[model samples]
Each structure stands twice: as structure tokens, then as C-alpha cells.
Target: MAKSNNNNRNMSVEEAGKKGGEKVSEKYNQEHFEEIGQKGGEKTSEKYNQKHFEDIGQKGGETTSQKKDKEFYQEIGKKGGETTSEKHGEEFYEDIGQKGGNRSRGGRSNR
Candidate 1:
């Protein structure tokens, strides 16, 4: 128990929570977190429909976009693009471009 003040013998709620969280972290590994996250996501999905998710997503996106500037978006976009390029290589973009071209030309690909 971590004491918040020198005068008090009791631990603060924040300090107790931190101590518990540290203990839990020491006991659990990455797989435990992933398993719990998957279960939680499944339960959330069962409780919420597509519309609920879409609405929340839209609200979150709107709020985030309002808070962030063009430069911030550009920086994140560049980082995401770099990560994707590294993961998928240049051929991934070529394949997507081909698919887009095919769709634009009424499923008739030039290639």
C-alpha cells in the first residue's frame, strides 16, 4: 500500500489501483490480455449492432478530426503509409490499383 500523504496511514484510491494493476501485470502475459480483449470484443459485438458501431465511429472520427490539424493528419498518414508499404511491399498497391481500375471500367480490367 502506497501512502499518498505523510500524515495518512491509508493508501489513496489511485495508489491502490496502481498497486493492483502492477500485480496483475506481473501475473499476466500478452496472451492473457489478448484472450480477455477478444472475449470483451465478442461480448461488445453481441450487445451492439453495426449501426451502433458506425455511429460511435463517426462521432469519434468527427471529434478527432476537429481536434487535430492538417499537419497532424499528414504526419500520421505518412507513418501509416510507410508501415503498410513495409508490411505489404509495392505489389500490394499495384494489386489494389488494378482492382480499382477494373471496378471503374465496369469489371473490365485493361490488364
Candidate 2:
């Protein structure tokens, strides 16, 4: 049993490579990899944005407790816009269309 465990722990390059290939084939099936990758990437970006927004919210709350006014809100909005532009490039704003105070659930069809 000890010898069997030792043998299991040591793998030849060909055996290890074959195992790796099997894992790639099994986990990244041709029909699902692209969809899985896209979902994972979107989730990652959403989490990042949520964390960033939460931090901004905390800072805004702290500042409001000290001195709150329309100017304070405007300043936060301006800073957020500037930071968004800087991170995503100036063309980012053009990608989003204006809404007449009614936005869909993220571009889903009405039907």
C-alpha cells in the first residue's frame, strides 16, 4: 500500500500531460467553454464594480455627515464620471444610450 501510494504520487511526464489534457477536455468542453468564460468574466467585472461602488458609498456617507448639500452630490458625481472615463476611456459614454427616466432591466426585450 505504501509503495502503491508512492507510485501514485510520482507521475511520468506523459502520464501527467495526459491527465492535464483529459481535465482540459472534460472541464472545457467545446460547446460550453466560451459561454462559461463569458459568464465568469462578467461576474468578475460586476464584483469589482460593486466593491468600488460600496467604497464610494462609504466615503460619501462619511462626508455627508460632515457637510451635505447639492454641491457635495455634484462633486461626487463629477468625480465618479471622471474616474469612469479615465478607467474605461472617453468612448465609454458613447456606448450607453440615454433613457427617458425609464430603463429596462438591462436591455432585455419587452416581450
Candidate 3:
């Protein structure tokens, strides 16, 4: 018989696994983690509305522009465009362009 971790006590593999699993569950319950994540997301959403989100995004873009040159953005944009084009057909771009043209035809009046 093999000696277990507990002094000179002997334990089976099944018993050891069961004991470790129970200890892990007691230490970190899955539900508790999910509850915290939901609460944080709710708080963030409450603070950052649509317009505020746009402003924050613009500021981040400005900072990134200062840090990186045009080539960096162009390369990233090329990769993103390639990925999107692969995922979506050409018609998707055409449809969105038509919608954008329609929306912009009247300038801010349409907005």
C-alpha cells in the first residue's frame, strides 16, 4: 500500500481526486465569479453611455495616433479589412456604402 500525503495514512487515487475537487470548489465557486463579472459589467455600462463611449473611443484613437504612425494604422486596417472581407461578401460592403451614402446625402439634417 502506498503512503498518502497525510502522515502514514494510505489513500486511493479516487479519494485523493475527490478531496482535491471538493477543496477547489469550496475555495472558488463558479457562480461567485460570474456574479462579480456581471456586477462589474453593469456598473461599466451604467457609467459609459453611447455618446460617452464615442468620446472615450475618440480619445483613445487620438492617443494611439500620437503613439503610432500612419503605416501602423494602415497595416492594422489592411489586416482588419482582409479579415472582414473574408468573413463577409462584397455585397455587405456595397449595402453598407449605399446606406452610408443615403444617410450622408442630407448631411447633419439626416442625423
Candidate 4:
């Protein structure tokens, strides 16, 4: 019964694509990714401007926040911080802090 239920959840091509995209990316070389990414970015920029980007980003953020609770975000944030700390070391935080400080030099700015 359980095996049949699990088998019922067979993947479609799109689902397979989404699941294996990371594996495919891992198999490829960096230059291939960079080239394809640049092409995709160019196409996206051609189709959508600043306002379009802002609208999609806003919608995505809102939908994600609604779907996931505070604890979910906190866990991901902690994991991301740990990964960054491992890869870049403490100096990475100092550089980022200075960059962030430079960006917010003036009074409170509106997003």
C-alpha cells in the first residue's frame, strides 16, 4: 500500500528538471554556466526593465514570507551564515560590514 502510494507520485519532466538542475549544474564547467547565465540575463533585461524586476521581486518576497514562518527563515539564515563563514572566513564579514556601512552612510533611506 505504501509502495503504491509512493509510486503514484511519479515525476513529470518539469519536476525532474527542477530536481536535477543542481546535479546538471554540478556536472557542467564554470564557463558553460557563465555563458548561459549571461545570455539568459541579457534576454531577461531586454524583456523586462527596472520596474518589472522590482514588481516580481516584491511579489516573490511577499509570497515566500506568507508561505514560510519566522522559524523557517531563521534556520535558513543561520545555515547561510554558517556556509558563508566557512567559505570566506571572518574577513568576509568585515568586508561586508564596511560595504554595508558605506551604502547606509546617510540618514535612513527608504527601500
Candidate 5:
């Protein structure tokens, strides 16, 4: 158990982690975290291949899907759609729709 100086009560692993993370965040800027994350990602990419990533992604997706209900997925999908709509204009959707239509009919070659 971890103890915080502020209180006599024992801190949980989660609470200690949150406190540590907050302290680190206060000390560092966004770029510092971004650089660390990039280096970690590069190291992970060097260690694992496409198939390993695909396997983990599939497993994670399966676990998440099992834990979440249809309404949860619908809510997330709606939120994502709203965010995308805000970022893109009508022309963007038109172009994507055209590309999708062409792909479905095999009118254009795959990228």
C-alpha cells in the first residue's frame, strides 16, 4: 500500500498512479509526452510485426465488443460521426461516397 503525505489512509495502486501521472503532467509539457510516446511506439513497432498488431487489435476489439452493449456502440458511432462531420465539409463526403461507389462496383482499382 502507498501512503500520501496529505492523509494517513493507505492509497490504492490506482490512486498512487493517478497522483504520479498528475505530478508528471504538471512538470512536463505536451511535446515531452509526445516524444516519449513516439519513442515507445517506435520501439514497439520494431519489436512486433503487422500480424502481431492485427492479432492484438482483433482480440481487443472482441473483448471491447463483448463488454459493451449495442447502445454503447451506437452512442460512440454517433459521436464519431458528429466529430467527423464537424471536421469535413459536404465535398469531402461526396468524394468519399464516389470512391466507395466505385469500389463496390469494381469501377476503380484498389489503392
Candidate 6:
């Protein structure tokens, strides 16, 4: 009976040791998981911030380009208008003068 009691006590101690080891392992695993999750979150945030800044920069460039395009079109339109005005003014005066001179010459000749 004494030997049997000693064996039972040893079994209980072994079971307790296994339970304690399992608890420690579980705690370590949980802490490791938390640390990994925190690192991943930080990396993701950094990437997002970099991408957001790039997008803002691209938008600013696009706006500047749009303004430049508008100015270019306005300058072209102004130049075109000036050229047309000059051409039409000269042609109109010359055409009317020639017509009057031809008519006067024809009347004198007929007389």
C-alpha cells in the first residue's frame, strides 16, 4: 500500500508540471502574437501615409498643369484675334479704294 501511495503522488506531480508548462507556453504564444500584430499595423500605417502624400503631390501637379494649359489657350486666342483684325483691316481698305478708282476711271473714259 505504501508503494502504491508513492506512485500516485508522483503521478500527481507529473500532471501538475505538465499543466504549468502548458500555461507558460500559452502565455508566451499570446505575447508573441500581440507583438507581431503591432509590428504589422505600424508597417501598414507607414505605407498608407507614404501613398497618401504621393497622391496629394500628384493632384497638385495636375492642377498646375491645368492652369498652364488654360493660359496657353488664352494666349493663342489673343494672338489669333490680333492677326485677323490686322488682315481684315488692310484688305477692306484696299478693296474699297480699288473699286472707287476703277469706277472713276471708267466714267472719265466714257465722258
How many pairs collide in each candidate, listed in order?
0, 0, 0, 0, 0, 0
TM-score of each: 0.83, 0.29, 0.48, 0.53, 0.80, 0.21
Q: What are the per-residue Cα lDDT tens digits for candidate 2 across 1-111?
A: 122235467666777677778988886667687888899998977778777868888999888768888887898899998888788854555445433222555655443
How does each model score on lDDT?
A: 0.92, 0.71, 0.86, 0.82, 0.94, 0.75
lDDT tens readout by residue for model 3, 1-111: 456778879878888788888987799889988988999999999988889889999999999989999899899999999999999997999878878887778543332
TM-score of 3: 0.48
List residue ranges in candidate 5 displaced over 4 A. Answer: 1-15, 108-111
Ranking by TM-score: 1, 5, 4, 3, 2, 6
- Screening candidate 3 with a backbone cut-off below 3 angstroms (N, C-alpha, C), the clashing residue pairs are none
Candidate number of the best lDDT: 5
Which portions of model 3 show Cα errors greater than 4 Å?
1-39, 97-111
**Global lDDT for candidate 3?**
0.86
Q: Summarize candidate 6's per-residue lDDT along 9-95 as a digit string, tens digits.
A: 445566667777888777787778789889998987777887786888899988877778877868888999888777788778677
Tens digit of per-residue lDDT, candidate 5, span 29-90: 99999999999999999999999999999999999999999999999999999999999999
Indicate which candidate wins on TM-score: 1
Name the regions of candidate 4 deviating beyond 4 angstroms.
1-34, 95-111
Candidates sorted on lDDT, descending: 5, 1, 3, 4, 6, 2
* 3 against 5, candidate with superior lDDT: 5
Q: After superposition, how far is residue 4 of candidate 5 from its true place, in Å?
A: 4.6
lDDT assessment of candidate 1? 0.92
Q: What's the CA error at residue 71 for candidate 4, in Å?
A: 1.7
